[model samples]
Target: MQLTGMFVHPLKSTRGIAFERAFAGKLGLLHDREWLLVTPDGDQITARSHPQLVRVRVELLPGGILLHYEGKPPIFAMTTVFTRPHRAQVWKDVFQAWHGDQRLDAWFAAILGQECRLLWLGAQSGRALKGGGEKMSFADGYPFLLVNQASLDDLNSQLAQPVTLRHFRPNLVVNGDYPWMEDEWQVIRIGEVEFDVMKPCARCVLTTVNPDSGEKNPDGEPLRTLVRTRRLEEGVCFGINLKARNEGMLQLGAPLEILEQRYSF
Candidate 1:
């Protein structure tokens, strides 16, 4: 299978930045989800609650970030230094994170129409990978989420109105594999990097949200279909979460090799 798409959400649940080539690291591609937004109480905020976050554009810059939203000039913040520690909770893990500043906080607050602040994933972020000992960035769970094109085609065949790939928010998309081939893949190599296939990525209502308009499907599609087709005791799964075994470069059109395989389901 060859890698056909590479995406990075510089900010979680926001617009993704497509990359032709990226430097793979322990957490993921260098800038993937290195920053995030959180409520003043230190709770994480994402598109699940405010789908409008999809309209926020994030551009990774050296030691800073550039945020663009419609009808206003882009806002830029340099994070060379951090403020006092702010606790951020994701799933079951909690870690101390650095808040940008009042100006940065106010910028996102206006965009989100709520009291929210930006948090930088710095030395304070120590969320451990599920199986691996390495730390991670602001990603919800794992470093990488991979999807197979064939699997999406199979799912689309069942949908009345097929959705695009963005709604699923995969970090990498590969072709030339059978539908759901990643489900059984234990280890794979993309370009020069090796990754351990950790677990299946579960689907949720977030899948029903339109990636472009922030509109949600009232019928709860793909997620509903997946429940009937791909459900397990855990949840409805679409992609496989990956933990990089070794850091290297990953690029579009790179051939992926199944270095090892162990059928689980």
Candidate 2:
């Protein structure tokens, strides 16, 4: 198999940026979901609860980030050094976030009718995964999420409407494979990088949203079909969450070889 597409979500639940090659970090891709939007009490807010956040567009430039949203003029923040820690929350998890000195919290609160804050994941943070396995980073659960192109094609074929990969929010999308073939893959080697397939990425309501518009469609279309065809004890099966076995750079179009294929449902 081979990597067909790569994406990085700089801020969780806002928007993501596509890339050709990306540095593999403990948290899947570098700068992916490193930042999050939260409330004053550190509760994480996402498009699952707030669909309007889909309108918030983020672009990572050489210096800093450019944020564009409805009713607000484009805001630019420099990539200068961060001093004070930005206070924020992610769901029930509370952590210190690094943020630019812009009035982002106030602006977001005013627009959303609640107290909201923008938080950036700092390189110095010691957040790690809690499972009894190799250390991982802040990625909701696993380090990396990968999907096969053929699986998407199969799902698209079943739907009356077309859905893009963005609906699934995978870190890596690989081609040259059949639907659910990745489930049997144990270890995947891409170029010099090696990753162990840890677990299956369960489906969620986020899969129903159009990543571009942040609009939530009827859930029954895809999720219902998946439940009937690919449902496990937890949820519908789609991709595999991977943990880095050996660290190395991942370039675009790199050949992927499955070292082990002993996975079972």
Candidate 3:
């Protein structure tokens, strides 16, 4: 199999930037899910809870980041260092995240109509997933999730409207044989690096958004399909959540091989 597309989400739940090549970090991909919008209570806001967040588009520029959403003027923020008063919980661990900029937050709050805060994952965060003898930085849950083009094609064939791979929000997109084949992949090797497929990523409401247009649609379309067809004992299987067994840079167009077909964990 070969890598087809790669993406990095500079901020969680916002539009992701497609890349030809990206550095793989403990967190998954560089600048992927490294920033997030949160409420005053430090709860992370996602398209699941706040569908309007889908309207937010994030672009990483040379000097700073740009955010544009429907019905609002674009906002730009420099990549300056701003510290949070206290550590906040994104998922399980309390992480020290920097708020992007006050003005940007104010603008978003005007739309969100709640006291919202922005948090950027920093180098000093020292946050990681705990358990299962695996480690991950700041991804929603898994370090890396990979999907295949054939899988999306298969799903699209069942739907009236075809969905793009962006609907799945995977870090790695590959072209391969069977639909949802990556779900059975236990270990895959790219270049000299090896990765352990830890789990099947569970489908969520985020899949309902059209990433390019940031429009929300009925979750039933995809979620219902996945539940009926791809449901596993663990969750609705779609892609494989991977943890690096050996770290290395995964270049674009790198050939991927399934080194092992089964793993206990």
Candidate achieving the largest TM-score: 1
lDDT, candidate 3, at 15:
71
Write down the TM-score of every candidate: 0.95, 0.89, 0.90
List clashing residue pairs in candidate 2.
Answer: 42-89, 44-91
The predicted structure with the larger lDDT, 1 or 2, is 1
Per-candidate RMSD, Å:
1.6, 2.6, 2.6
Candidate 1 residue 72 C-alpha distance from true site, Å: 2.7
At residue 232, candidate 2 shows an lDDT of 74
Which ranges of candidate 2 are over 4 A from the true structure? 78-82, 85-94, 99-102, 132-138
Question: Which rank order by TM-score, best down to worst?
Answer: 1, 3, 2
* Model 2: ten consecutive residues of lowest lDDT: 129-138
- Give the C-alpha miss distance for residue 67 in model 1, angstroms: 0.5
Query: Residue 107: error of model 2 in Å?
Result: 2.9
Q: Which residue pairs does candidate 3 place in steric collision?
A: none
Model 1: residue 221 alpha-carbon error in angstroms: 1.7
